[model samples]
Every structure is written in structure tokens, then in C-alpha cells.
Target: MTKRKNNNKLELIVAFSWVLEKVCDSEFSLLLPLSFFIIEFVIAIFLFFQFSKEEEEGVEVAAEEVSEEYTFQHTLAGKLWTENSFNSTAFKSTILNAWKLKNPVEIQDLSKNLFLFKFSMKRDLEYILRSGPWSFYRALLVLERVTGEEQPSDLTMHFDTFWVRIYELPLMLLSEVIAKKLGNIFGSYEEMDLKDAHRIGTFLRIKVTIDLRNPLKRGTVVKFKEKNRRDHFKYERLPTFCFIYGRIRHQLKDCEAFEDLNEEGFEDIEEQELSYGQWLRASPLPKVIEDQKKRDSSSGTCSKNIFNVSSGQSRCKTKEK
Candidate 1:
């Protein structure tokens, strides 16, 4: 409605301009009184000011409407970690297939591999954010939840949350305190499985925000009772990372260090000679646990068994018939 009004005002201005131009250019204009030209010019000036004022107001209203429409509370600013260009159509299709989002998601390509994913529901947004860092064609999708007044391009894309499994920690030091400390060595610790301390598992699972710009942390050395031991690190759902430099931003082939090695007459360097390897990727969770998660998500209920720390066993809760 406001746009139509503005269009009408613009048309009126154009019409007045055309009329003034014709009157001044025509031979009959010399026969008109001086007051006639002055009055016509005054009316045109008044209409021009009125149109300008209304157009400015209309713009403000339009901006407000857009702001109200897209709150960006359930939006994520994402950028693909790749130097090559990407096809937005293929990227959108891949996202739909990969996410299988229950709620509709609006994808806006911001050029330069940047995108905005606006989800209809907050739950969908949260699920996507938590399940990341997602990838497209082997390139890591760096995502950050939209917050405050930052534009899509201004949002930080360096840090991404990943489930890092701490391996080879002594049984005695597997508590939450130790988990937080160890998790921080990679990045800011977000969460950890509290029950992991009680059970003797392959590794203690903890979520942390890793800096993609930095080299991937392989492991950290710990000292206990004047004895030092090495603890390995593994990332769950890890995407393509540069084996040559241990960075998550790009693959080994695209790495500058790899090119430099070739330029230095070391093109024959084997994969084994790289600083990183497949060992950094953590194995998938057990099938039973994964099925339980699917069931819980489908039913919208968390009815999984509680682990009894004292007995060092999982205690299932049977429902009454």
C-alpha cells in the first residue's frame, strides 16, 4: 500500500515536470502573464516537497515492517569454508536433504559462499546449530546463530561447536571438573556427559567451541604423581580438515603448505608424513543409543533409562500397563 502511494506521488512529479517543460519550451508561453508562470512554479514546488516528505515516511514504515517480519531470532549466519564458488541451488537442495528439517527453512544466499538460514521454528534452528558443524561437498559450513544488531557479513564464523571426545584419561580423573579442564584445552567447554565419569567408556564426550583458524589440537600431555601421560583427542562428526596443516578450514590438497612443499622439491611426501590423520575423528555412538535418540525425538519424550552411578549400570524404568 505504501509503495503504491509512493509510486503515485512519483508519477505526479513526472507529470508536473513534463507539463512545466512543455510550457517553457512552447512558443505560446510568451503570451502568458508573469503571475501565471510564478503560480505554476509554486504549485510544483509545493507538490515536490510534499512528495519528498511522504516518500521519506514511507521508507521508514517499510523498514519497520521488514524489521518486524524478520526478527532473526531463529536465524543462522553461515559461510562455507572454501575458496571455490558454490551453486546456491545445489547447496539449498543439499541442506534440505541433509537437515530433513520439520519446519520450513528460508535460505538466503549472501554471495561469496555466505548464507542466512531463517527457520520457521526455534526448535529447528537449535537442532541444526547443535548438530553441526555441517558440510557441503566436503567444505565445512561455519555457522553462527544470529544475535543482536550484527549484519550477516559481520557475524563471526571462526568458532564452531563440536563434540570432542577425551581419550585415555585416568579413571580417577574422569569427573566433571577434570572434563571441563581438559575440554578447555581445545576451546571454550560447552557441555559434557555427566554419567561418563561413572561408566568405563572408550572416551569422555564433551562439547567445545573450536577455533577453525587454529590448528586442530591432537592431544594434551598431563602429569599425575610425577608421571606424565598423553591423552588423545577425537572430534565427532568431524568434517574435512587440512592434514598438511591440521586446520579445519580446508582440505590438504587446497592447503598452501602443500603447494610450498611441492615448490621445495618435496612433492613425494606420503600421507603418513602429514601432521594429522583420520584418527582425529571419533567413532559413532552405539547403534542402540542412536536408535533410542531417534525414538525420543519422534515421540517428543526423553524416556531413556537412568544410569545408576553407584551400581555402574543403566537402570531402565518400565512403564505400568
Candidate 2:
């Protein structure tokens, strides 16, 4: 339709020029200056429209090139939740060693403490996500798989996956359905450990992708068949969190909530009223031994990939490689 319009405009200009030439060539000599002004005005309009069309095409081409360059696939973007600066070289070397990928991957810094991990294989990408939440220098390494055209610096990474153990559930409620329900309450439920389904242990472990923006949930009261029971939560591989806010992003000293309370003349009182304690941090379980135990387990069939996360089913909307 635009092409047709352009053609019609060109034809009109041509006919107008022909008539103008005839008039200029004839006895209409007094109107010569006015004719010249009309001709110049027509030429200016045509040139303006012509240049605009070319500019539009050029802009469209440039946009396509930019989109292609920034488009990422099988990639993970990460951010270290800390105010302190870290050695980029050490971070790259340590993360490369930690991943242990069969194929080499590219790790690039997006900003201060923000990194992007581009994977050659989807399997390698999946492994990194499943085995999280990863850390560096005791600071929580928040991971999110890359999707769409989002820049790494623009990515909001307040969520990370953790194996949260819910202690004190009755034998009857110790099922996957119950586990999913409890896991959702904390964050996004990923997977439940069913290796020791038959054996009742101290706690039931479930993989949950939780938001660090919110304070960690202390515990919840469960009511089943009119029977009320209390359950406690313990997060494995938990990183630095604000005790005052129950948030994992910062410490009590760096907490905004602490600052607000302090401003209200509650500094001394709030200092002793730390809500979250060291009990929230779970004891470190040996990764190698746990993998070995999962391998030898004969009771339940589970995913061979040690990382229990499934991106499609994740409650947290973040990406990591």
C-alpha cells in the first residue's frame, strides 16, 4: 500500500512538472519567479519524504542487528548478594571449577558482581540450576536462567533455590502432595526428596526456590483433620541475611528496617530483639556423601540429575546457566 502511494505521488509530481515546464516555456514569463518558488517547494517536499523512507529502513535494519547480538540462549545470569567487591578473576576461575562442565562455557561480567554464564549445552545449563543455590566468598550467588531480551544488569535476582527441610510432620502427611503444599508457602516448590520415603527421618527435605526480598518464614502451624501441629524450617546453604528483616539480601547492620527502627528511638531495644537467629542456618551436609547415598538408595525412583530444579515448574521467575 505504501509503495502504491509513493507511485501515485511520483506520477502526480511528474505531471505537475510537465505542466509547469509548459507554462514557463510559454508567454506566462511574468509568473517565472512564482513558478520557481512552486517548483522548489515541490522538490523539497519530495526529497523530505524520500530521505525519511530510507532513514526508516536503516533504523529497522539496525534494530534487527541489535536484537540478534543481545539474544541469548542456554544462558544463566547471576548476581552476588553483597555490598563488598569481589575479585573477578577469582570469581570466574572458581565458578568454572565449580561447574565442571564437559564443554567449555563463557563467563562474562555484566556489572559489579553481576555475571553471565553462557552454556554450550542445555544439559550443562540444567545441571547448574538444579544443583544451586551456589555461593562465592560466603555471599549468596543468585542464579536465573536467561530468557527473552533482558539485560543482565536489569535482571532482578532476589530468589535462589534451596533444600528446605520441614521438621515435625506426622507420618500420614509425609507425602509429595503435602511437601508441595508446604514448599509453596515458603516460595516456589521445585522437588521433594523421596529417596527415604519409607524411613521417617528428623525432617522432610524439599527443594524450594525462595525469594530473598522477603524474610525467611520461621514456621507455620499445620491443621490436619482438626489436629494442630507446628513445623519448623531450616534452609541448607543459606547465605548472609538481615536478622532484623529475616531477609537474605543484607545483614542486620545494613538492613533498612533496622535504620527505620533506629530513627524511631528503638535502637537499643531493637538491638536485643533480633527476630531471626543462627538456628535458621542449616548444618552443612557433605555433597559427595549425599550424592553417594542418593545413588545407592533403592526405595524410590528419582531424577538422575543431582540438581532437583525444573525451570518450567519453578515458583521463582529467575534464570541461571
Candidate 3:
């Protein structure tokens, strides 16, 4: 009876210990899920705050960009208003103000390259202003001021003169000639010395200096002789000033092949002033007879004697009269 009672007490103690362990494990499992929820919620809040901050920064940047564009437009408008005054003082003041407002960083960075670009822009703006009643001059002037260059003087007069001459020309011919000349100017060529006349002839189909500033008036013709006994005459209708004034010569005042054309008629009566009209009227002589005729005309009495002796030799006549 004593051994049975001892075994039953040991079994009761083991069963109570197992129930306590199961209760502790269940409580730990519930707490672990709650801690994980708290950690996830904190991380979500942190990410949301970060995203909001980035969006605010983006909005601020966009606003700044818009403000800059508005400021530039405003400056351009102000310059236009100032240009309407037509007073030098007002123009200078406007330019100075614009310069003061320009960004120092840009000025510092582009100073060197800006020099030529600013000059070209200023020149172009001045031309546009002088051209018509358009109000875009003010905007162009403001741009020039910011870039740092002075507008050309008498720009309006030059533009007017250029257009007047260009309009006088036949539109089709003018476009064609200008296009051809520009191509010639920019085209590649073999290296040549400016002083060497022979080298120039080797490359250029037609060598002439054209002045772009002043075009030729209507009814003008330039003529040249080719080796094949043909005359080449180029008629000008409202040609550019360069066509009229530009002279091609081996030396100063020394025109090639036709240097005599530049001389006065005091030396030879037959050698008259070579005008466009005279060149048009002149006719070419046969190459074989040209030299002989010139020699006979120059020798006068001597040529007559030579002709008489040649005639006598062919007839075998003894003249005793």
C-alpha cells in the first residue's frame, strides 16, 4: 500500500508541470505578433514622411523655375517700353538696368564666348529695329544687354539701303546669283598664294571680287575673252555694290589681259574708254588675220612697199615706165 501511494504522487507532479509549460508558450506566441505589428507601423510612418518631404521639394523647384521664366519675360517687356521713348538716355538706362539684373554665374561662365555672340546678336537686333515698325527690337535689345554687346550705329540706314537694292534686283536672278556666289566663297580649294595670278586661274572658273555692301545698278555688263575666240559677257541687273566696285588685278590698278581698258584715249584714237555700252558693241576679229592686219596698219608706207615687191615677184615684170 505504501509503494502505490508514492507512484501516484510522482505522476500528479509531472502532469501539472506539462500544463504550466503549454500556457507559457501560448502567451509568448501572442506577444510576438503584436511586436511585429508595431515595428511595421513605425516603418510605414517613416516612409510616408520621407515621400512627403520629396514632393514638397519638387514643388518648390518647379515654382523657382517658373519664377525665373516670368522674370525674363518681364525684363523683356520693360526694355520694349523703354525703346518706345526713342531717347538715347532712356535706351542706355534700360540697357544698364538689364545688365545689373543678369545672372552673375552665367556672365562669369560664358564671358569669353559671349563676346562675339553678343556682338552678332546686337547687330542683328539693330538691323531688325531699323527694318520696320516691329516692336521686337526691345526684346532683342534686352537680350543683347544681358549678353553684353553694343548695338551697331546707323543700323537702320544700312538695313534700309540693303533691302532697297535687293528689291530692285530681279528676284529669281538675284537668288540664283547670290546662292552661286555664296557657294563659291565657302567651297574648298587647293592651297594657293594670294599674290600668284597663275595659281588663281588654276582653281577659279570665274575670278572676281564682289562687294556685298553696294550692289550694281541695272543695265551693266562685264565682258572677258576666252582662248577659243569667244566673248563672255555677264549682264548685271541691279547687281550688288561688290559687282560694280570690286576690281580683279594682278597688281593695284593693273587689270589682267585688258589693262589697256583702264587707260585714257589720249595715247591712241582707236583705243576708246571701255564702258558697258562699248563692250557690248565691240566685235571679235579672225585670229589668223588679226595680227597681220594690226602689223599693216601700224607700218603704213613700209607695208605698202612690201606688198608691191611681193606682187612684182609673182608677175616677173620689168618696170621701166
Candidate 4:
């Protein structure tokens, strides 16, 4: 009996030893994974804070640069736009004769184009910009403003006028009707320009100005109302005006290819084009267009090439076809 009791005690001790070893192994497995996750979490937190600090530092530097540039920028600025050739002596003389000048310092010819003028006083700068669209020879100044660039440059980058074409409408519709229809779709257009449908069965086309954004997609519909009935007119964007001429600064009408298009073809801004057929027709490149051509030639602003059917043929179409 004493020996049997001793064997039972020995078996119980071996069982307890196996259970202890298993618990220790299980604990180690959980602890090793938890340790790795905690390390990664700490590393991510450190990187986030570091990136935030760098961004704050960059903003501070930019702010400092802007602050330093603001004061001298406005006082040193001037802008001018006119049809006449730019001359520093002539500009200074004109300014002095026209307005009050405070400390009229000797001016600098910032650009050959008269884009910026140096002035000593803020009042002089303000006064000069406001002094009427000063004229020279029959040309008027179109732009005058205060700008802050050290180099002579245009205040804004864009053309004052752009052209668009309106789709299918009545044959020889009155200009007033065209104006009302155009005003309904586009806001603040300059004039109602109509083109004779040189193409078959098409009598006239109306074009609308769509500026500073993506043009309306193809087949966009415009609805007009007449006596409780609706007329839907569809319109689309014309190809870029410069693409046909292969140059910039001039649109299709202003191009030499369009030398045939006279001021008569365009509706007057003050008075819309009121006549039909004979009115829509131009009298063989009117004197006004010829005079403009002479002026452009004098200013060294000739269209580099002629691409109309009237030149008997077009250099551009020949190359493309």
C-alpha cells in the first residue's frame, strides 16, 4: 500500500510539469505578435508629426517672401495700351501735359511697348491711369492700369474679342431677332455676326461667344419661344480660329484670308445689321478694310499668309489636302 501511494504522487507531479510548459509556450506566442504591432504603431506616429512640421516651415518661408514684395510693388507699377508706337519721351510729355504730376521723376522706358512706366508718387500713378483713353493720331488707348511687375508685361493674358458660330436659323432673319436670341443664351456679347451659308440649302448661321471655359459640347440645344410655340436651335464650337491661319493674335475674320469680310458684314454694336442679301454681301473688300490693311502694314502687323478662296486658292488647303 505504501509503494502504490508513492507511484500515484509521482504521476501527479509529471502531469503538472507538462501543463506548465504548454502555458508558457502559449503566452510567448501572443506576446511576440503584440510587441511587433506596438513598435509599428509608434513608428507611424513619429513620421506623421515629422511631415506636419516640415509643411508648417515651408508656409512660413513663403509668407515672409510675399510680405517683403508687397510694399514696393504697387508704387513701382504702371501699364499702358495704345495703337501708337511706344516712345518714352513722347509718353512722359503727354502725361505731363495732360495731368497733375507729383515729383514727376524722369521716366524709364520699361518696354518698347509702353507696358510699364516708372512713377514717384501714388497719386500720379492713379491720376495717369484714370486720365481718359489718351489718343494719338486716330488711335485710342485700350488699356491702362497699375501693375506690379518689374519687367514690362500685359496685365492680363487674353484676347479682347473672340468669334463663335450659331447653327441653323431662318433665312435672312432680322438682326434684332438674332440679338434677342443671342442675348438669351450668352451674356454680354459684342455684336451679332452673320455668315451667308455658302454651303447648299443653308441660308444663314448665328454664332455666340463662349469665353474662358470649355465650349458647349456638340449638339447642345437652345430653345427660343415664339407665340406659345418652341423652336430649338442647336449650336457647337467653331474650330480654334488660329488653327486655320496657323498663327496667333488674329481670329478668322481679322485674318487676311477674310479680307473679303467687310465691316458691313458685321452688325454694328450701336446698330445691328438691318438689311438682307445685298446687306449681307460686302462690296469687294471695302475701303475701311483696305485702310485697316494699310495701317497694319505700317505697324508691321500683316497676316503672314492668305488662305481664302478669293486669293484664287489657299496655300493652307493645298498643303493639308
TM-score of each: 0.68, 0.65, 0.16, 0.28
**How far does residue 66 in candidate 1 sit from its true spot (Å)?**
6.6
- Tens-digit lDDT string for candidate 4 (45-98): 544454343455663345445655334433533334222365667766765554
Q: Candidate 1's error at 308, in angstroms? A: 30
Candidate 1 ranges with C-alpha deviation above 4 Å: 1-66, 196-200, 262-268, 291-321
Model 2 / residue 17 / CA error / Å: 52
What TM-score does structure 3 among the candidates reach? 0.16
Q: Please report, in order, the local distance difference test score of every candidate based on alpha carbons.
A: 0.72, 0.73, 0.28, 0.39
Task: Point to the candidate with the largest lDDT.
Answer: 2
How far residue 83's Cα lies from its native spot in candidate 4, in Å, is 6.1
Residue-by-residue lDDT tens digits, candidate 1, 1-321? 458556765776677667667777888677446635665676567555554444556633344555566677888888887777888899888877767655688998877899988889887787677666677876788888776468655765888888777888777777778889988898798888765435436678888988888999999998988989898998876788888888887777777778776655445767677789888877666555555545545534323221111111122222335
Q: Candidate 4 — which pairs collide?
A: 165-207, 166-206, 166-207
Scored by lDDT, model 2 comes in at: 0.73
Off by over 4 Å in 3: 1-65, 68-172, 176-321
Ranking by TM-score: 1, 2, 4, 3
Q: Per-residue CA lDDT of candidate 2, range 60-150, in tens?
A: 3454456565446678898998887899999888877666665888888899999888888787788677777777766788888777568
Give residue 318's error in model 4 in angstroms: 66
Error of 4 at 280 (Å): 20
For candidate 4, give the lDDT of residue 291: 56
Select the stronger candidate by lDDT from 1 and 3: 1
